[model samples]
Target: MQTMRPNPSRSDHKAIALMYLAFFVLGLVGSMTGPLVPALRHIFALDFRQAMAAQWLVLVVIGALAWPAARLMQSWGVFRLLCLALGLMAAGCLAVSFAAGSGYFASVLLALAVIATGTTLLQVAGNPLTTALGAPEKSHARLALAQGFNSLGVLGGVHLGSSLMLGQDAAQGVQLTYGILAVLTLAGLAMFLCGGKAFPTSALANETAAPSEALTSRWAWAGAAAIALYVGAEGAIGSIMINFLHQPHVLNLPMAEAGRASAKIYWGGALAGRFAGSWLLTRYRAPRLLGLMAALACALCLTVAVTQGPMAGYAALAIGLCNAIMFPTIFSLTLARSKAPASAVSGLLCTAIAGGALISILVGEMADHTGLAQAFLVPLVAYGLIALFAALKPAIWPQG
Candidate 1:
């Protein structure tokens, strides 16, 4: 699994194709959990915090390990690491299929953490590998196209996993779904392993450039904080959406209905908004557009927190649309302002993913103490801060 060399061969193209498949598979598996929050609570007989932890522990592991595993990808080739990641994911799925009893919830979470570790490694190896796949000029384009498959996967994962795994006999359904996912992962592993000469390791050291100044800029740190908040808010909102949507005061929808809406309305908004944000950003200032979206998201969060009914549910779901372009915008914005190199800025941003874990715990606690409605405040303030950052972009950023 050496670094890829210049003038990628036909095999390199195959590897890239399969890599998109890998992304899709990862998304499919990840989406299955959020919609199951209520069912998970009942099956495991756990409190709100523990049930949330059951789903969130994986994110914590990903945040903790993604960066370190990325560094390890230098010593180990990207392809090899990807294989390891998929293998571990398959192993976790298999473990879940077997660990079906009431008390085995902890074991299931541990398995999920293993899967998360694999996923983090896959992302670390996969993103850069896309850039290395072919011509340097087309790297961003290639990555964007590959990411589209990820959205499709998410849509499919939630909708499909919910239909199959959230039935009356949930334990058996979960077992069967996990079993199938295990099989699919193994199939992906086979494809990558057979990608002979597709990802042969070549020199990557010279390819990465790091400017020292970006690390020193205060705005770089600010941008990183915004990223943390953004990711945290996204994950926090998404994790609670199923339960929230099912609340008597919220939408009061059935689990399956809530799950479908979560996938279609929530995740779908992200898919559509990415396309819309691209055009909107082209017509407007980046910072200004970011600010506008964040403010809208903030308003929606407040609406959701204070109101009750279907409209409020939709408002909550609409936040995903606002989130669509944020990560790319924030990443680019931070890079623009930082004296640090693009690579360094990227590394710093990944650390912010830990926000998903920390913020979830905070929101979970809030929900336990108060109610889900009030827990909305956590992300509400987070989006407000992001809006503020976007509005103050000129003052906080260096003047060229």
Candidate 2:
């Protein structure tokens, strides 16, 4: 790997700022569904599973494009690729703004698919590059910092959608909200282009290397499964929090209030946890923390599944605290475990994020058949799997 710049220049700082901005935007746009679930259902006249299908499309694209993105990143480099992803996001937002006016569900879905395509590429480039920008030993901390901004974006976006996109007129709300997103995306693209010369793409060197070791490692696969389950479980939980809180027997807030509530508990907890996790990972073994957090998340989900009222609400919210460090921790641990290059391991791990689609769909369907609270069993199971992976990580990678 190319060594990082010990003393970054002015342009390098600009590049880092733009990259982190892109990460924030990714979280903002990606988490839109959770808060807008009520709007999607009301506007489209759909059920739980149908509204949840929005994520299915996004994750499908992410999974499909992430693995091949290593070659693309190699050819284009991070700066150019990020600019392209921002452009794609802007275009998707533009499409959404227009499509939403007509209340056409298909158009919005298509726009999100395009957005996810860009996001997948961005993640493939951004996640590892954060570590590359500094010392290698601090990768876990750096990734946590990137994901901290992502969590902030999620918190902001959810509240934004709740206020602007969920109301008596869903189409109007979407139009206004997405119009703002498009403009912001374009602005981000412009800023990145001006400083584009400073960004490096050394990780893209994965293209020149063999993937045999990464492909063969059991720890790699185990880590992939752990990531998949973690994402899936998080998605499942996010997808339901609005509706779960909307239940009259539970929090019983209106859709907007429910969304605000979820943002505070779900995304807010993540935002705080990630910033703290950045420091915590420096003090603790990544796998041990991962196992403990996953176990705690499992307990929280189980509590949500079986309980009601404020207890359930508190439990569900607490899960985000446990979830805060899992992704970056898992990514860093898996990267260490892999014998392949950073870029190759990043692609595989990014693709495994498709678990969100599969698991969220299952949770949604279960909600349709059973109840929203009980449907949380799906994430409960997922968290359990991740906990198992964390606990057995030493067995899986005894040499470490």
Candidate 3:
């Protein structure tokens, strides 16, 4: 069998579009779980800790699974891995729906873990594949565009979850939504399996490539750390926003209204920021652009932490705009200069995705003890580190 290699064929536009569509669907499936967070809390009568644990369960599983999945892509190729991921997501979605209907909290949590496992694999494979397909200088813009489609998926996920689950009996509405997501998962699986031959094969021929021999060194771990912290900071802020806004002496917005408004503003900011980033990368250096965005994010996190009412929520939402470019920018910067081992290093960087799990838990604990207002400080620390990394532009090459 012929080994797959990255193609610079601009004629493969259809393949590019299909990859973006797959990413869009992946984004939709991932964020669909967000709006369901409140419903899960109500149905299980879970305190903040338990509810947050359920979400983190998925993130931890995804992080744990990413390295193995990267290895699998080396053997099976991206299309097959995508198929496996979609199938897992489908099965997990169906299991969660049934568990919700049966009021089985443990079962629901397990199902979410399953779904996350698949999505993590898809992420590990898909992102690197996209960057590899495009030109060196254009990689950031391509990733930004692909991720913009992801933003649209998030917007739709929130809208779908809100329309279906909000104000309805929590159990039934939530169950139906999961069921719908399951259908979408299956559809995605079928499409990807049929399109199997289009995507490039993994960058590593096998997982055993000597660390020092590889062109793209694990030194990119610096960039990966930034990504993990970035994800954690983003998740922490969004996860706590509703609870923060509802506190008696905090923002004090009504629960139902605040939840919906918060979702809109947060995703709205994400959407706007990604579009702007796509345009900016065409002109500016990614490292400089990332530093500016991190600074803006720090300022916004502080604004949300200290202010109250609509102002606080809006400030929090604006952080999404600052966040929009950081991930793709960091990813492009890290991988752009890399050579043969880009895929393996991509998988390594992808593990930082677990940040969503860890950061949120830390913030949740802080909220439990110090109050949501103070917990916001957790991400502030992360953003500061991210800023320093942005300034350094550390090399991904191996040193003796």
Candidate 4:
């Protein structure tokens, strides 16, 4: 394997700033699914599970494309790959904007799949690159800080999607919102092109480990499982928030109003917690903090399951706070403890995000069959398992 040394003249801070910007755009575009669910269902006349297929398809594309994206990053270089991903995302957004007026459900799904493909490439490159830009020991904290920006994007995306897509003229709203996103994505791509010379290119070099090698490390598998559950639980809850809030027994708000409420309380809580978690991770062990948050999230899901009115609604929203640190912490912890090639491990970890596709379907089914409140049990179990993973002592492995 060849190791590339960093150029002393290159600025790590510039690279980090670019990465944070990329994440922010990712959050903005990626978060539209939850808020769009009601509009999709109404337009397509879909049942709960069918409506959730939009989220499921995006996640499935992520899982399916992750490994290939990792391999592409190795050969193409992170900078070039990021540029390509951003361009692809722009194209996808434009496609979605155009398709919104077509009245064909499949066209929308196809456009989302294109967007998900771009998002997969971004995630496969972005997470590890962010960690590599800083001190190795501070990987968790650095990632958490970056994710805070992502949550900020989610906050804006949620509100924009709710206000635009949930209104009386849903099709026009979808067209305008995604048209704006395409422009923003193109702007991000321009920034990367203009600032390319300042990036620490050497920091993102990958080891030439075969994909199969990552499977040998127990930490890789453990981390993959945790990532899957974390994403699944988060996606399921977010996708259902508007509908759940509209339940007569819960908040009983109108659909459009409920979308706005979910955006502020649910994703907004995540925006707050990630900043706090970033600071806390600097002082506490990543595993301990992860376990604690997972337990708290599990308890909150239980509360939502058994309660009603504002209590249940608020309890559901509060899980976003617990979710704030999980993806970054679990990712960095696994990277720290695994001896596998970083690229291979990252590919496996990203692939595990397919769990969102599976888990969200289960949540949708439960909502259709039993009740939306009872559907909380699925993620409740997922969180319990994640807490168990966090509590286990880290296995000794040589650091890369």
Per-model lDDT? 0.73, 0.80, 0.73, 0.88
Alpha-carbon runs more than 4 Å astray in model 1: 1-16, 131-144, 200-203, 207-220, 275-288, 332-345, 389-396
| Candidate 4 ranges beyond 4 A from true positions | 1-10, 395-400
lDDT per residue (tens digit) for residues 185-299 in model 4: 9999999999988666677565666556778888889999999999989988999999999989999998888888888989999989999999999999888999999999999
Q: Give the TM-score of candidate 2.
A: 0.94
Residues 326-358 of candidate 2: C-alpha lDDT, one tens digit per residue: 999888877766666777777877788886688
> How many steric overlaps are in each model, in order?
7, 0, 0, 0
Residue-level lDDT for 132 in candidate 1:
62
What digit string (tens of lDDT, one per residue) describes model 1 on residues 1-400?
1133468788778878988888888877766667555557767777778878855687677767755775666567666788898999899888877775545787778878878888878876676566567764444345545655666677887787677666787777777878888998899888877774566565344324332233576666787788778877887787788888989888998887888899898888876776566566556667887888899898898998888998789999998888876765675566555655444445556655676677778888988898887888999888898887787655655632
What local lDDT does model 4 show for residue 136? 68
Question: How much is the lDDT of residue 350 in candidate 3?
Answer: 70
Candidate 1 backbone collisions, by pair:
2-200, 2-201, 3-201, 3-202, 213-339, 214-339, 214-340
TM-score for predicted model 1 compared with the true structure? 0.85
The 10-residue segment of model 3 with minimum total lDDT is: 206-215
Judged by whole-model lDDT over C-alpha atoms, candidate 3 comes out at: 0.73
Native-structure RMSD, model 3: 3.3
| Ranking according to TM-score, highest score first | 4, 2, 3, 1
